[model samples]
Target chain A: MVSKLKTSLAALGLSTALATSMVSGAFAAAHETPLTGDLVIFSDMSNPAPRAVMEGMVARFKEMNPDLNIELTIIDREAYKTQIRNFLTANSPDVANWYAGNRMAPYVDAGLFEDISDVWEGDMSENLASTKGALTIDGKQYGVPYTYYQWGVYYRKDIYDQYGLSEPEDWETLKSNCQTLLDNGVKCFTIGTKFLWTAAGWFDYLNMRTNGFDYHMKLTAGEIPWTDEGVKKTFANWRELIDMGAYIDNHTAYSWQEALPFMLNGEAAAYLMGNFAVAPMREGGLTDDQLDYYQFPTITPDTPKGEDAPTDTFHIPSSAKNKENAKAFLKFVTSAENQTLINAGDALGQLPVNAQSSVDDDKFLKEGFDVLSNKAPGGIAQFFDRDAPAEMAKVAMEGFQEFMVRPDNIDRILDRLENARERIYK
Target chain B: MTQATLPDTHADRGKRSFWRRNQIAISPWLFLAPGVIFFLIYVIFPVFQSFQISTLRWDGLGDPEYIGLENYRELWDDPAFYVSLKNNVLWLLLYLLAIPAGLFIALFLNQTVTGIRLYKSLFFFPFVISQVVVGLVFTWFYDPTFGLLNVMLGWFGLGPINVLGDPTYVTYGIIAAGLWPQTAYCMILYLTGLNGVNPEQIEAGRLDNARGWRMLWHIIIPQLKPATFIAFVVTIIGALRSFDLISVMTNGGPFGESRVLSFYMFEVALSEYGFRMGYGAAIAVVLFLIMLIFIAYFLWSMYRETRGR
Candidate 1:
């Protein structure tokens, strides 16, 4: 880290700071120039591993095109969410990191994101085709996905063995597994709903399983009413688990990260969480033999499986000064070789978006990639928050949290959500 | 020679003398300008702007469409709004307990005992710590799984109460956390008030057979009126603007049961899932009005007190 900073600082001093950002004005006078111009990229790869990946990608990109001097600024992830709004309209970087699906709707609608349909055309379409639907708003692709991960019941294989249980293939077996775990004084599931979105994950999988992907999509899209019979049945299924005390006690007090200790300590058997959780669980001393993954089991017969796989993407702001270099940078990012390198197990530990890219030979990564690509025939949801508009997601997720605490308040909660849906959709 | 080139006329003389003539009146304004301008720009204008924005139907990213109080109209039917308002009321009523609590602590500690300064600082410790730190400490203290609170309760075989997680107990739990700092603040105020208490009056009251409750009510209490007034004003304002403890402890959770108006305003406008600037502005406006009522009453009482004097 110290050496990297020294080199960057040395580069600045050698060029009198004119070789990079300051020379952008010079590029404007020429109109058409070499790839030698400045390319500013604002990214939210703030965590240590992702930070290394971002810095590594930049170093590699710089090496390929020695003429280009790219300026990278990494913001803290939480701050980046709000700062993206300000910087997009005012001081835009050439490229920025944002999420996929309806999460980017506001920026897309406000004309902040540059339409990159041309980038996605031809061979590019087939390469990054998996996340194209996620980045597209109103039939126009706005961004390209770098990596994504699957969401499922990440469980302790060791705990299952102790209980003499196998991976559940159906809702009946899933419940019986939960019941056995509960009988042995273990929480069947560990979830933290304090932030409210974790509860939304349960709703997403349950609703998708009970009804179907299309129904779930329409419901989030505000076409299906909250009080619909299908929605009620999903909640009914959820209520059964709640009634059984399957989730950890006082879950509302813990963040998703804080709830990991339950599974780590064997107080809980499993967590219905995103694949990102594997890193922490592994860090908490669970060996590969101890940890395992399974697709959330079926509820209604013949219901096609659906999975939550949120994609993180990069985009060019519409008002960005250096569009040419930005496009080249993005192309480099989505290239098969680069995707494989950046999304490798030692780096992001996530599934690569590029279909042509090689999946890393890690057990969880391979299973996640397989589950997302093949097992989820119904469709891939971007998550409840990303699938629905932000306002509706917040209100609905809060309702989901309330329902978890008070199962009997389901009718009142449905009515409240129904009311919100009318107004939010309007 | 330096003055030789100066214009010598009635108008020139008047111009030169104008600053000198108006210095007393204008100098105060010059001092006040920076503060007043900042106050107007930062505080007063934003309050008015919130009112204007509340009348719109816009997210922060797009052009705010003037929806003519539709935001407020929505808030009228909104259950979350009522929950926030109800919590605000609960905060106001419960937060006032600090005054009496602080007074008692202050009175008890108003002694010349050994290591008295140490004891006073110990009592004043909660106020000195940052609210965020206090909130974090209380969160762990109230943790249902392995918190000190539940462990202590286990000794009595009482409870494993998830104070921050249960709707019935969440708001009160946060309020209790808030009271830790607030009572210290009130204690400090009363401590200072106790310093200026008249020894002669206490002696005179003792001679008149006024002791214990009677002496406190007649002599000591009236003397602490100034401190009491300041404490009342600050505590009320603090209670109305309660956000940090609620935010740090719960983020308005156990299903939005712990949200005060400010936290709700922030949640609706700024939180990741929240983007309805218009709705947030409406919440801000409502919170502002609630604050304005107490401010007006306090200002009116001060005016009446001064007039009577």
Candidate 2:
């Protein structure tokens, strides 16, 4: 109750700061701070809409502070992941886009990111308070959240209706529904484990559901042994589904995009994916009535439904040339107005960071927002890959893919992951 | 003035003539310096650096900590490392098939019926296509659903086999794709070699009542040794560096079953999911050692032949 009151008070304080700053033109950059020189930004907003949004942000920021030269270099999203380490140490950008969880651990531990706790003070802290926890490491905030989206079972609603089935609320019901779909010549799920991270989604939900959120966190953070009883239980649950032949065959051959045709063509009835899948699914010709979502069903029944909502964020590199300009840009990005603009339906189509910013009216956005905000009681995870260290995540996800293909190999896979965890976390 | 100056210049030339004195030996050294320098910097230095890095634990960022033999220790225990080594050996053995297959194709195409030029070019088409494109084409060809291979198998009612997906067949499937272009490359080399064949020897063989296999083996093959040597050398190198097809087709997966040392190195070091520079360098060191053995053998054999001549 006390924490809730503090949050509201922070939000109120933020509202006033945003208003006064906007009206007085102080946010043209930062208050009483004139910006000069180059404000270089390295963004992984390579996808068309996100790229446009990045460009728009730069243009708007430039318009406001004409003295500032903002050089925005947008890189291919996947390529940016590996390149960030190089540039952060060598050719540091003023600002960069990264994820908001333990994905930031390597950078934070290496002291690559600047301590941006001052940016989070007063008005900014309240507005962007929700994701402050995600960007924090060892009691210090390192970055600010720009966007996030939910991961869930995106299913074919029409196929469910055709098979006289409804969204399963439990494991048994889910299996039964899958059995029905299988008996009627449809695979229960269409997954492409070729890149391996797709399989991690299943692990994230299965482990979280079987054990609960805190246990899942411990496992990812390498505190819990991968060969633990809880981990085995999670794999056992996954095995039942695999044994039922519930997934599309040759899934290891397809990427998530390639796997979409199975769901789109109705050979498979559902896909366990992020909100990003909705765009491609819609583009592939599924109607709103045809496509629907459900939170991953409860496995332990009362494990307090934790959710995966991977958040993409912005950070200032500690070695940046333009620190003052970078800080101002970070504040400007998280301002209620900019969050609303960039995360609009026509732009990122994702959840805004600012509590004061309104969410888009799109059905997926609304439901994802509701599930992330109200329905999820356990906690929000930054997905498996983002939550775990990069090396462990890669090894574990490959193990997940192997288990999916050969469920009997669970013992070997777990042992391998346990070995990796010991080496990686140490 | 001209006569006096000429005598003085002649005296100066006596000292400057040190270059002229050593010109025969010095010219080649001077000419070779740039190539030698580039080879040392680009090739030799990096090779040594990889060895140095293999003794450390680096994430390609921050200070790389010296942990002598640690990365190699990890590699020794790594299952993925063993899988890659075994796959590389398998690739080396099967990829050699391209040589005999290329010879057969070259012999078949070494004819002059009408429009044989068009047929020869057609036979040479696979080598002309980029490996990336060939990789893509084969990926689609071997795709599980709606693939031409599966469709044809459907006629035989045999299979809808996912060649690239199944761990059992994945390496073989990729090797087969590699063989297509490699066979073409060898065929082109053999054809060029066949053009330089001594017709006098063929006549001598015919006069000795030698024909077909005997005549070709004794007469033709003996003269094609250089081409055969080149073909064998290239094929081994190609087999060892089998990355592009694996990358484009399966990405060394279906549980990373198709990974060779090079692809595995890229995966652990440079790929989006990977950043273990130390481990990658260790793998690279192993690959380098493997290549070095083959290279040493090639050099020894070449020197022996040259010395014999």
Candidate 3:
């Protein structure tokens, strides 16, 4: 009787399992389509704007070359860095999105990316020149710049005007405006350093203002000592701001979006964020007329300031089978008409790299160009995290947080960063 | 004529013996082949490959240059490695508290009530969700100004503390997040064990005047050993292999204060950090070896138990 019961129970479990699998199998079969081959495109920009651009690109490319097939894989933006690294090593996609900077160094050094300099020269030559030197590793162009935007202090013009404040042209004026804002019971600044990357903008503004272009480049390249006078001065200024109660409290718990509410409620005066933040500003119920941008105040009168925008790019993986088709697709996307379409979407407020590309009619694009065009000749990209290695970026940002919350730990903070830098660079 | 007949019979016997031996030898292998092949390919092969990769300096591409034990040497001096290792130990030690705590909750909820079954499933919900979702929920729960925890604390007139900000409390905070799901897992295991408890044994203990803690120590606790063992096994593995919670919650932050070995390894080998794959592998090897020691202890104890049985 016991044996018979055991057999019956086992039969019951097997049938249930089989029933579930068959149900799911039928669901899967409904979506199945025959394909000769698969190409996967990995990217971090699955936010609506970039996603639409990518989908359109894929559709156009597929239509142009009906014989070729591709699969577009959108990785979460936050997790993309780590996930794509694993994918590239184990099962690389045909083409993938990546940032340009020392960020791309490891992949380039490993030869994970296929060199597409020839493609750029032959087909996309004019588009390549517009990016200047942004996408080059050594002398070769490894990827095509898709879109990029300027970074600056985005503030409420209405609040500034009500307080009789004009956009500050120099450091002293900026500090005074901050004080004025604080005096009015509004937080002078709002920022979220939860990920530690936001602090890079602050460091960039200060370093660019104090040390100028060459030193800024060298500092980011890890060629200069972070403890050097120029770097220290930037930290000292940051400390001054912290001491004045200038920044928002509990920044560690807040993400950039969380900080938005404080600004929207008029509890905060300004947010030093990227151009993409403008869309959210509008989304958060701020009118277009209420928003404005200003260069982070110039610290040194003689320093030349250039645009500190980070650009995104795409490259063919060394393992790609459709190299020729991929290059053609890349070339097609970078064409003036496609780029115009990409930027015209409010979600992607990228400054067109194409000289012929114009957004004279769009106020946001006009605002972006006005700021970027007047930037000092040797404007530097954001420093600290971007300049330092990723490991160092992690350590340095953590140190910045510690320093912010506990100002007395300056010695310990600097020492920790120095040690991390040595260990990583060595 | 008789000698020739004897030779033929001897040859026939030898041929028959050979056939029987060959069949006997191949039958056991045929039975073992599937599982052995799977274990080799999925588990053993990757481990050896990782070990081999750990010995060479490669950036996940290009030619791998042999750098023999330099990675291990670097790990000795790497401070982040130590921080992460220390945190992993903290996670393991503190994570064990889940088992007893889980049992306490399980025992309380073991009673029949109007909605007892629904309550049990609700209690077990944390275990069902992915850790990423759990991390996000706890991150909000621990948010300084707006988090539910702070709102609860506000009734006592305490300032909103940045649970994730302070390096001192960050790891503990993340561990608390981990404990949520881990406790749920243990609770389920204990509930099953409690259901299988012998009622006659309980009645006999009562006749002997045993009850409550005394009864638990002598009878109930001993009976729950199988569930307890499985819980311990899972908790230890989960604690040591913890990456997702740390990654999602802190990214090993407030200054690498929450760095765990697994995350630090990935950061070192591939992320924006240096491509020290060998160094990363050495860190992994250390983690693997630590796990091995625990596994050996578990195996030895199991071996003794099985032999005694």
Candidate 4:
């Protein structure tokens, strides 16, 4: 009788376990089975708007195609360059962000990036044309540029008002403003070169305003010498500003984000940075009416002007598990409506690549559009460190810092940069 | 009588041969498999690949051009190479100070008292946190304007000295940060050793009027030799492999002033600054060789001690 009871208890336990497993399976089936394959996208932008827009698109894509899944990883900008290279070797992301210039050359050569020339020819010609060959290397398009922002001097209008100064249009006027601010016990400029990339903005703006677009391309492509006289003159101009006590101390110890307090407290008069500084300005309690943008002051009268507007681009990796799904998502991302949603968001202060799209009516963006549309003749992207190899850039920025602290060492600085260029390029 | 003798001899021979065959088959494998597999996977295979690649000029991607010895030749002229080597030596020399300082602390806290156990644990706390956190803490502490050290100096009307910004003091500042956790680690090792030291010996020394420095040098230190040796070995390796502190604090900066060999190797191979993988491997090989010299000395000492035992 005891053995029969034990047998019945065992049967009951087995049935209960079977029922639980079956129930879980039924529930899983009932849940919307989105895409089942894998897609990985790597990006450097960590702001909420871009993430929201991209996540929404991923969900939509997953719902439309129930055999695919997507994972998006955001790397901090400083570490992305090194970390991305490591990722490419073993398990490359299906799609990833890469720079558009000679920076992509190394990866493209290694077959790390997929050759999407066919994608451009068939589906993305408009996207290709709008980016102006920025994502093309060796007559082949490897990536699609999704966002870009103009770089320039962002200044406090209240300080300009207190000093009876208007936004300077040329080098002479800019120098005069700096002197005036110095005389009035206000720091003329604020910069944080702690990570060293922020210094590139100033250099790019100065170079673009001095040399034309062709020279900028030549510099980026490693065709021009680092010790060129035009470059030297830019350094000399920067030195003059530094000598006049134009910049804040301990700049080396602070990131650009950390310098917000200086501007919020009215300790520093201006910041030379990308349009993305608008978010920080708002975060620091500065209303749009308080902050304003001006073209970086002209350095040469006849120089071809260029906008130092850095851009972000997406590339399909060669190692993607599901290339078709990734390409489909890429198509979805570049669709006109999606581009509009992305541009209207807070993550990127980018104007729409699609000319016909309606941008969100923000005053700051309207002002940005006005500046971009009416930009100086022969406007091109800024070409300081981005134009140079990363190795040369590291040495060159350090040289800039040294020159800032000790203006007399300009000759040594130029020589060292030239030496670095030679060593790095070879 | 001859048949009986032959059968006995054959039985004895068969038994002896069976045992011998089994021993031969098993003993060789038992000695070889663990060490050979481990060496192949962890050390030998990787070293061979690194050596093969050091002859090829590859940017870590694409087809590598077999340019033999070119990377090593380039290393001869690389100034940053020398700077990193010098910084590494400095790291080693200064890092050794943690050993004696740790021993000093262990002696001080060896006495029994209320809350003494908590005191020992509190002293060991820095070692528990990661090197990355320690680097950040020190970076903030060495900030010229806002750092604790500078603020204290300002109270005395002395310094707003740029500890990290100036290339001169940058490496020293990083070394000071590294020492914080490293000293804590050594202190714990010594504390454990002190707890196990013969109390009867201490009492006997006290009877002989041997106390303080004389007692420590002649009696205590000799007894703690194994702990001292282990402490020295770990500190040496930690100092030589000092990468995280440099990376987190300065990124080998103020114009690459604080770069040790390991960070320099990484920057050369994979950083945005460059991707000379061959050159980086060459640097690694050089570092490995330097480390091997010390490792050989350690092994030889261990061998002699064991053999004597």
Candidate 5:
């Protein structure tokens, strides 16, 4: 009697499983287009402005799709960097915030990130043309970039006006400007290399200007050796700036934010920084008119100017439980309207990547859009750390920081970087 | 005492007798089981697992590839590894200075006086605040442009010393910052030890005219051996685990000059650099081995003491 009961119980369990699958299949077939499921997103939108924008977007998405349950988890940026790999493997979220270019390559290579080519083949193909190159690996698109901003020399207009200086257009003029600033008791630049990546802004611009964008990309991609003459020339030009006392004396002690005081006080003339610096500079008591943006002065005049444009993106992890809802969420978030919302949001003063998105009315944003669209050659290269393999980037940034601190050690630093590149890229 | 005073039935007496007969043999293992289980799970298992992981090329996500000793081979030529090892030695040697410094402070505050407790707690202020906060405070203090250290140095026409920037000075600067709290910790340990010193023995020493250095060296120090031993062990462990202050102050910067083994392992495993779990685990294994030497000696000495007792 017990054996007969057990057999009946097994049959009941199998039928229940079959019935649930059939019911879900019927439900899926009924609404083949509209998404209805739990959509979980993990983001490192810790910065207040971006966080607000993301929250707004999520609320709007919920309103649009009443059937979908959206769960948003905002983690601290630094913690997210480590936790992402773990979560992507174990308890993967449907959508996650990450960077584009080489920063996304490792996850893509490990098959941890989903290939969102179908989503890209839809509206994104036309809307996000420029950023597609950054998110593509092995001919498959993996992420959708939402925002990026331009990096250039942010200068004190008041200081430049007082010194009777023009924005340097080429290497020679830049040196002359440095000389004039130095003579007038102003340092040519102020940078905080304490975080290391700030120095990469200088390296990226110099390398791009000296050897052109292709060479810079090749070097960052580990195709060219650091000991190459093109690499050496970049350092040679950087050395001249060091010899001229162009930067703040003890830059290594300050982070990029900490170095802003020198420029605000007119002790230093310019800072090679991204557009995000403008908000902080304004908050530090500089007026809109007092601060002006200029492209990094031309180094090798004829080289295609490659500007640093670090793009932020979102992707679906391969292990996501709600793939359909994740695609819908990605589509909604990257819409031109939502992109414009993010642009106008108070926290993030960055430009949207969408072609049809409304531009921010801010002066710096206008200047950044103009520079990035008109001046940059073959579009923009992601900043150094974002463009290079992470291990190589870490060593390269350290090498740049060391060179800044002690220019005399350039050859040794280059050799050390080459060693790191071999180990990392291998 | 209450249990013994209570009346017992014959069956209860029999049960008590049985427990009394077997308790010596079974009780020790019962008491030790929880601690041993914890040690096996948290400490011992991880050490062996790290060794296993060091032999494989895992990225902490996918299947680990067995790569033999390739990670170690790579570490053999890794300049950063040597730099970290040298810094570790420097940290270990300089970190020992805390024990003496702590003992000095303890001696200074050992006397009875009004409001002495308040003063003692105030002296221990550095230990109370988290190390991360102390690190930030020191970073500001060492800031080249507007730091208090630079301002004071300017008064003497001396320094705009880029303490964190100069590789020659960065490690020392961080060690000094670490020493601030470490010294306070040692001071507390010594103070507790000082309190437990036999007053009658001190009275005997006083009657015999053994005072000051002689009293401290002969009569006092021998009694404080247990505290010294503890202080030595903790300081060594603290020195080996010196990651937070280095991470906060310099981040092994000015060309990776200030990296310690722990920070280097973290950089390899979890930083913006893609995770090289195998390589990082190899580094961890080496650090564990180095630490194991000290641990083995400690356990051996502890065993001898227990055996003698």
Candidate 6:
């Protein structure tokens, strides 16, 4: 028995010595490199291409740091929206995929997300200067943006060529273009409001163009009432489009994807959509030369031009266990080289957020980059949903959709939205 | 003295042996304890917890604040709430049509033909699939551009109707989709009930010159009371709980025109609107009360039937 105890004690001592050496080895490696721990990421990139891109990124990340471990749990988009709130508080992952702007406010306000300002101290701060404002809340940065895309009019260049029409520069030209398109037996615009947010794109552009960016911001922040005259003016402009039969008939029955055929078949002259719609349009047999990108026609000539640019961002959770590794991952992922790698991938059609990052020499990207990078009077507004609080955004979108369906009920819809705004802001 | 002592000892023995003699009765309760505990935890306890949650103001993430009856008061003023309530009434009224429709289908298919079994299985196919899938299939069928319904209507020069988009017709469209599966479920129940019908009574009614409607009313219908009772109960519950179809097809859209209580509760609690858990709980409590009234009546009727038997 004594001999057995001595043998066990020796074994224990040897194991402890080995463990100590391993710990020292890891610490030495950590000093040399910032990546040496397990990182868990919860992503909502459920689409096939985005999922593939994410998987590829993870593989490349693994190659960069052989010792670092990554656990990516990609969830469906709709499910992720609800599940994030639960997981962030109860079982937070080291990193999470989210949107920028007001969409990130609730989580940031609740302290569920970590402030990664130190990550933004050097190269990142310079590389991603344009996106810095979006991730900042209360003068503290909470996330890092990777990519964003511009929303604008994707018109049939061939149709415009056939009619000898130049891209509209202002509201009068836009109305005349619609008349020309209508006279030529083609719809002026095609949209699918079945998902509701598509209507918000129209509302965003109209409101920003008419009232400028400050008023749009104030309106979405619930500082301004929905019944405000500026809001009324925006609707009146939208009503002009409806009056001129700008959109396709029965648009509410189709999703944005389902509405693509109208533009592809030349039944509709243009689609006001994001850059992501370009690939689909090409796939549907519209050649690159046949389609051209243009900003939404100027509604009010002197109103500073505000464009919708929805940004996708990454953040570290406050309850993250491998925070150091997460920071390392964020830095690695948001690097100019890595951002270029993601931009080049087929999963995303959006431009890299890092100003220094290179993108594929694609035509639409060049046009979007030019338009978005230009000094517009009003600057950029994230899409309506991202700009406004989630509750207000939902009600606003519904109201917008209802207005599209029946423009006469604008008063009732605005009244309802005002009630919701008061209640939600209260 | 011995006799008196014996009588007292016998009484003491009787008292001690009572539980021992009733072990069979006690064992059943012991067996039921686990199920009862689970039911209380999962079903009964949550009902009361939701009621308590309704009196508070919570976002499901932050600390809950007590604001008694405010949520209910908000519900009173909410136009969306009224829309949901009105739609629910429409659903209840229209959803009942499935019962008679199911009986009609069951009676038509109640035959011993060579492929009748196959036919019955095919008829039951919709109920077997998930309602989510049914909603999708119906949504595609109602699509304005390429839907089969539109294509067919095109032939008649009648419609390219936006069935799921227009507020006036959206609820009816959803109800029609719901009825597809619900009718199939009811048909199966009636089919089983029909198999247990008394042949002797049927023959007696036939001999007395009763046939068709008369025969079915006096003989078959009376005997199908249990099946009808179960069908009504399930259909009512199903109508009240019609969330999946509405969620999949409309998501209470085209201006929240087709809102139902179950869908509204989910929208309020979960969705991108952020979690107004207390408000959602209040909506849930109202739905629960509505369901409770029907359930109470069902239980009372069931008790009466058993007591009379």
lDDT values for all models: 0.89, 0.89, 0.77, 0.76, 0.86, 0.86
- lDDT string for model 2 (A1-426, tens) is 332343334345446445643422224435455567889999999987888788877877776678888888999998898889889989999999999998898888888999988888777777776677788898889998888888999999999999999999999999999999999999999999998999999999999999999999999989999999999999999999999999999998899999999999999999999999999999999999999999999999879989999989999999998998898888888877677667767778888877777776789988998998898899999999888988899899888998998998899999999999999989
Per-residue lDDT of model 1, residues B119-192, tens digit only? 99999999999999999999999999989999999999997999999999999999999999999999999999
Per-residue accuracy of model 1 over A1-426 as CA lDDT, tens digit each: 742463354343434323322222212322344478899999999998899889988886776667888899999999998999899999999999999999888899999999998777766777777788899988999998999999999999999999899999999999999999999999999999999999999999999999999899999999999999999999999999999999998999999999999999999999999999999999999999999999999999898888899999999999999997888778778876667667877778899888767777789899999998899999898999999998899889999999999999999999999998998887
Which regions of candidate 5 fall more than 4 Å away from where they truly are? A1-34, A345-347, B1-24
Task: Give the TM-score of each candidate.
Answer: 0.93, 0.94, 0.85, 0.87, 0.91, 0.92
DockQ for model 1?
Answer: 0.74
Estimate, for each residue in A152-218, the C-alpha lDDT of model 6 and write its tens digit.
Answer: 9999999999998889998889989899999999999999988889999999999998989889989
For every model in order, the TM-score on chain A comes to 0.92, 0.92, 0.86, 0.85, 0.91, 0.91
Q: Which of candidates 1 and 3 reaches a greater DockQ?
A: 1
Interface RMSD of each: 0.8, 1.2, 2.8, 2.0, 1.4, 1.2
Tell me the lDDT of candidate 1: 0.89
Scored against the native two-chain complex, candidate 6 gets a DockQ of 0.63
DockQ of each: 0.74, 0.72, 0.36, 0.35, 0.58, 0.63
Predicted model with the maximum DockQ: 1
Residue-wise C-alpha lDDT for candidate 4, range A250-284, written one tens digit per residue: 77666788776778778888998877788878888
Tens-place lDDT digits, model 6, residues B1-309: 455445654475555465655766998998999999999999999999999999998877767899999999999998889999999999999999989999989999999999999999999999999999999999999988889999999999996899998999999999999999999999998999999999999999989999999998999999998999988988998899899999889888777899999889988888878588899999999999988899899989989999999
After aligning candidate 1 to the native by TM-score, how far in Å is the CA of A133 from where it should be? 0.7
Native contacts kept (model 1): 0.86
Fraction of native contacts (fnat) of each candidate: 0.86, 0.75, 0.73, 0.45, 0.80, 0.73
lDDT of 2 at A333: 85
TM-score of 2: 0.94
Each model: TM-score of chain B? 0.92, 0.93, 0.91, 0.90, 0.89, 0.93
The count of residue-pair clashes in candidate 2 stands at 1
